[model samples]
Target: MLFSFIQSHDQNHIALRSNDHEITYGALLRQIDDYCARLTDVDVLGLALDNTIEWLLWDLAALKTETVCVPIPPFFTRQQIDHTIARAGITHMLSPAGLQATGQSASPTIPRGTAKITFTSGTTGTPKGVCLPASAMENVAHSIHTMLGNDFAGTHVCVLPLAILLENVAGVYSGLVAGCTIVLPQLGDFDANYSSLHHHLKQNAATSAIMVPELMRALLLQVIKQGPLPDLKFLAIGGSRVDPHLIKQARNLGLPVYEGYGLSECASVVSMNVPGHDRIGTTGSLLPHVQASITDGEIVIHHPGFLGYLGETAPGHHLTGDLGHMDEDGFVHVTGRCKNVLITSMGRNISPEWPESVLLAQPGIYQTIVYGDGDPHLSALIVPTGPHADVSACIASANETLPDYARIKHFRIVAPFTVENECLTGTGRPRRKNILQQYLSPLAVKETPMNFYDQLVAQTAIARAELYRVPQLVDGLQGRISRPTYIAYLTEAYHHVKHTVPFLMAMGSRLPDEKRWLHKAIIEYLDEEEGHEEWILNDIAAAGGDKDAARKAAPNLETQVMVAYNYDYITRKNPVGFLGMVFMLESTSTQIASMGADAVMNGLDLPKSAFTYLFSHGSLDIEHMKFFEKTVNQITDPADQAAIIEVATNTFRLFANLFGAIPHVSEVRDVA
Candidate 1:
């Protein structure tokens, strides 16, 4: 009764779809019987075929013939393929090249009752095969069939590669047991195109599918652009951490995303969310046949252990290296992997998944990883969700919920991980060791003494210049905008500028003793920056606008928010973050002021008296930026550097928002 569908289901019912062809249950069984006859003598077989009906045939034939089977993922490197071949002592191989038997017919010794040897994702190290009993896998599939009941008996598409445990058990076995047609596709044809995947699903009229988190993200994005998803009965997401926000967004878009949790040792799925008993954040309640308990903060399953690694003894209780706890409602919640805990150089142990989850909570950051093992503080490598994504603001927002030690100190945008690039497992989990080897060299903060000022400037230049490229500011600087628009820009600038001295005073007063030298620098800045607001008033008067009226007017909403955030930064958050505000103003002034002043004067036909503030600051901030750079470089604390970079990034975004609020002219008229 392992494959009960063969005898229980109607012989004429369609059971499998592949290559534009359908196979009925009767036809599929006849094919499996023929295949099984050929494989009767083979003790162990390696399946390297794509996700196709042929793969199902191979698997079913092996199960019927009592031939041990090991699935070889196409993403595996040649070395990995060779290792699996030798380790499993595979006597026969089935791949695109067709089935061939090796000369070595001596079957390798595996644990008793071993039917399937499923490999882990192989992200961190060489993957170990987890031997599983056919009965156990069938037990899981039958449990799913019972829990889901008759409502889920629609066509199921194989989205993940057939080598994946989830698809093999949940997609193929359970779908058949539930009397649903299983649609199989070539792995290469699918690629990472979620639209194409969705199209394939619709074409086949598939009602259920299995997806990793990355695919879910792509599908969600496509749905956002297109429309709601098809009426899917179930869309299971697992193989990695599923962001709660991502799940919520997917559900809102009618994607029918249901998060789940499992491992290869647990026969693909131990817990999953179904229609009537779903929770947004939690993975799901445990399956009826599986027993999961937490001992010393690590999840241990009382289910059958792997038959054994090829040529090794089976370990007793399955200790899933993952950390989690059961909710009051019996729902399971996974925090992170126990093995992934990062021990900082400061002697504090932290888990990257905790903060990585917070970062993923923001819509702009599509994928991210945090690393600080043996370092003073943590840093991240991120992939943005879209071209116009504000990464800095997202990090700042995420940092609000994290502790100081666990907060991301620095981050850089990187290419998103994909199976094609070998940066991720067939499942969605990142290949942490490979990723560290590839990106760590450049992403890691260098301990060597160098000009960090230039480093900061060079790193932030493109994004900073983008702020000046805002359409309204660009036109204003070109003297092609109305005088009222320019007046509004100056109006907001005046409000922020007026608070400069007060902000500095607050920063200096709150400085920690270790950074008292920075306080001294702030005092010096205070002397030079005091009374700068009066100069804005003078410019307003010379431009033929009422200076008193501008002075008495309340600051615009954008300017008020910017100033309020700065005050909050210095008082409630780290006072050192105030330097970010300084960098925002001075660096921008040095770059734009002198050129802008000339452009404004010629564009407006303004008198020399009206331009004093712009022209003087244009020259003055050049020296000020040099001083600021030197002072920033002098601070050697990694935490301090992080604070400065974080604040500076946020300040630039706020400054852009402030500029964006002002109105621009409708017509392109030359000022002069």
Candidate 2:
């Protein structure tokens, strides 16, 4: 599709616009042709430009010449840019010039420049350049045309800075492939919220525009304000992480929304949700001819034709840092990220994000992060609900009934979470290590045992033990608190939960009889989580609220390790992979709702509203679960049904202990 656009339009229609000036495809082609004629050796040069026509010209030229191009955001400072460029061994630099880095300096040395470097956003430190080949840029253009086909032809506008790979590939290069009129709005001028973006979209009869999560959010906000754009054909939202609620809300608002997966390494697209065949959770099925899979729960792309690295001649397949599953239907659904996986010391593979969502759902916790992979226990960072609210107390309360491992062991109270000013990524995912560096340092610097919260509970348990032991029995409770008792308490709690299981499955949810067996199994194993307070409080109170007695409870994370290579296999990933995940999560939602309700009603005393009070799965994840279903319903891929079953089974195992197992505490402990 894109090839046809390029081949036919040495002249014909408009190709790009920046602010006021409009350039024809013929003219645009001529500029690229000229650049190509000028610098043939500048195969893999760097592309760093704001959302501008010049950037488009260079990008198209690079693609046309088959140069492996490295496109970086204009916002990256000199240090970042230089690090990438030097690593990639790029020979050229292209922009209108004056690209600012924090340290004001420029390498004004080469005409055969445009030094391209595919920098790893860096899992550890010192971001390394993946170093794409100069001529590989065109492969992405080829990939897009092969998948979406050449039918797309209309006005496509720029809503993002041109440097982003998604915006560059789909927004600009794709448009050029279709020979569409490119509309460039004024810099920094967006629709009042998203309404204005929609207005401009309608005004120009925009068929497509590239988007990031933030842009999609702004567009949704605009849709709410100004209503939906009627003519939008494809609104590709990618880059960074995207939430399904946001997608569904946009769909409800009447946007022709579809999502896909791609990486800077893969020329911006690995899979996408087409208009009719869209799936919510899985990135749309692999684009025509692209191959994707989940190998041991990690995403691997096999594009027989992949881009080469910065100036390097070596070639290989692209393996991603993302962890995902391929359903029976073949669509790919990303789960937790492999790079960011938070494995507890107990070997329980927990997606901290899974719990983080629950915490964030609470209005009280503006920002909450759970971290303790490989540590003895889980801990968290919470932005306070309010000035006066005690964060430690909140943490304690939240974890009161939680099993030992998943419970937060320590925490920091950082209020008013701010991503800007370099605390977070442009995409808002925590710079986890950075977060550790900032908050964790305070404890050591103060020269206090970072055991402040730990001691608080310890002291409370001691006091409680004393109270329980009062000889006069002044409303006193008596018992010796010990770790085994807390464990026993957890055990008893689980036992009391027997009837809760069957009742919830029967009373709640919309599952069929055959699938109801899952509910039955869930119910049977649910005793472990019952009467958690008794387990925690019993140990503390037995010691007369003695902190020392409370401290006797040995802490350990849930250590259940099971490698799911069967479903998590990297080779079988297809659209089915996506559908499989969708179905799996839905099944779990049904089970969780049933078990959660039982836990609450049987004896937990939790509020009915707490289930969906925007603080837990009842609140945010319910939407996530739903979107997976909806995405599946939209899919035409035959692999979907099978994918559903595969993902569901995997989901079951991943959460088996957390959901199905019961709690057991051997002793009563003080209120820490």
Candidate 3:
């Protein structure tokens, strides 16, 4: 079918376009013929080239000659590349340099009629090879072409790497089958500069393209900053759960955008939102080649062409581990991954993707992974849009639309997940287990003797690191904050510190008789914390601010939320968790309070009296640390220890928010 499309088309028409090179249908057919002649003796061919004309030519040649083609992803590590080579049993390897023998002619026992072996970068361990026959690949391409109709026959730009199965089947083969001019730009050309990519697409008069959500985000941002590319018509985004709001934003800007769903197991595209048959939230209607049904809450595909894994026998149907349901309109609404589902301690099953989609749709969040398995509530690790994004507001807004159990109760701002970090898969899907291990895993305490205190510290190291990233804390510690900023910090501090004694008294009152030892420590904490808020008020006066107004002012939303969380935890959930707040506050004061006070006094030329609270708290917490360590180490109940750790982690994150809510010196100037 592909050959007939190529041969019957206008022979002089341009079929493939790279940087400056162009291949007409006649020339492209000759190149494929030459490659096929060369691969006659090769049973398995490994194409490891960039997204250039040569890569497409060799891939087509493999399809024509019935040779199993294994396209190696360039982002793969050396070990992964070697594993693919050995696992696929390649006879010949074709790279930019040239074709050479892999020195292994013993072909692996893949399923019969396997024409292409596409490897998926799974969440854990090595990549897995999915054997796909030419018929399956062609069926997907034909279905896409038929669904899209003649509107996409102008030009199709390849954005994602050709090695990705989505780009290989949907982008390249579909373009060929539709007799559209296929543009193959070097992956670096677009990846390095989205501005240049927009220009490249416009220059080529690109009418259609396929990309993952990550690339779509970049392109959308570029299109927003620059003008829209009027020539580009259809943009299909997949490879991960796309935030529906992102699609709406793109379309609102007059950029034709659509969302799709597929897996390599079923050959690229299973369902997609196209021009006339589009739906915003769902992943469009199913393609004609495949039929989907929800079996035990899993999206099972009755795709007969799937030849199964590299060595496994073909199953009756592909059980897509994704959890979703088909709507009355036949659109698929994917909720989340089955294996990635979080079953809370309260026996509620929560899919992270359900809340994740909401969070990602918000303005400030760039990427997020929701986690809380066997725990009381869900928490997220968010990658903000930029250094100064109002992520708290974003989470709060998203939570408004979610149910109580599905809301993100706690979140820690972290760096973006990327291919370089190994926390994100190549196709823009978060490696859930890898991300949890990297940012949220507790230390292996069994490897060494660690008390509860040590375990709490080790477990919350990441959250602590994230806390230190708050701009206000960073500036305050560096003595770069202005007088108003310092006053603001003091004001918020007074509001939360004023509750310290009250919180201690509440915890002491709520404790059972068996926890009298903990109650004793709470008494000591109350004694130390009783007059701390008064010290803050006096410092406000010493700093040339109104002490009366400072005391009358309400806490900001961040501080209020933190205080409320503690109050609820002490009164309702776990009274022992109050110790976690104590540990965070005192330990932090001991470490940085005095140092930061000295820096601020020296930098702002404020009198020592102005830092009364900070200096006194710093001095008082040194002894409190010794006491805290001893008391917490005495905790033996696993539930109590877990409560303490959870509270400590949340306190650090909340305190970070409190500090973050304070306006920076430059921000104040900007407002002025």
Best by lDDT: 3
TM-score of 1: 0.66
- Considering only N, C-alpha and C atoms within 3 Å, which residue pairs clash in candidate 3? none
Error of 2 at 101 (Å): 18
Q: Considering TM-score, which of the candidate structures 2 and 3 is the better prediction for this target?
A: 3
Question: Candidate 1 lDDT, tens digit per residue, 224-330?
Answer: 43334455779998877776866865675557889899888778889999999998888898888988899998988884545766667766678889888998898
Candidate 1, residue 344: CA error in Å?
4.0
Worst ten-residue run, lDDT, model 3? 663-672
TM-scores, all candidates, are 0.66, 0.54, 0.66
lDDT of 2 at 99: 26
- What ranking emerges by lDDT with the best candidate at the front? 3, 1, 2
Over 4 Å off, model 2: 1-4, 9-11, 37-44, 62-70, 89-92, 97-116, 123-125, 133-136, 149-152, 186-205, 303-315, 345-347, 353-369, 372-420, 426-429, 440-672
Judged by whole-model lDDT over C-alpha atoms, candidate 3 comes out at: 0.83
Give lDDT tens digits, candidate 3, residues 273-294.
Answer: 9999998989999989888899
Worst 10 residues of 2 by lDDT: 472-481
Q: How many angstroms is residue 136 displaced in model 1 relative to the true structure, after the best TM-score fit?
A: 1.2
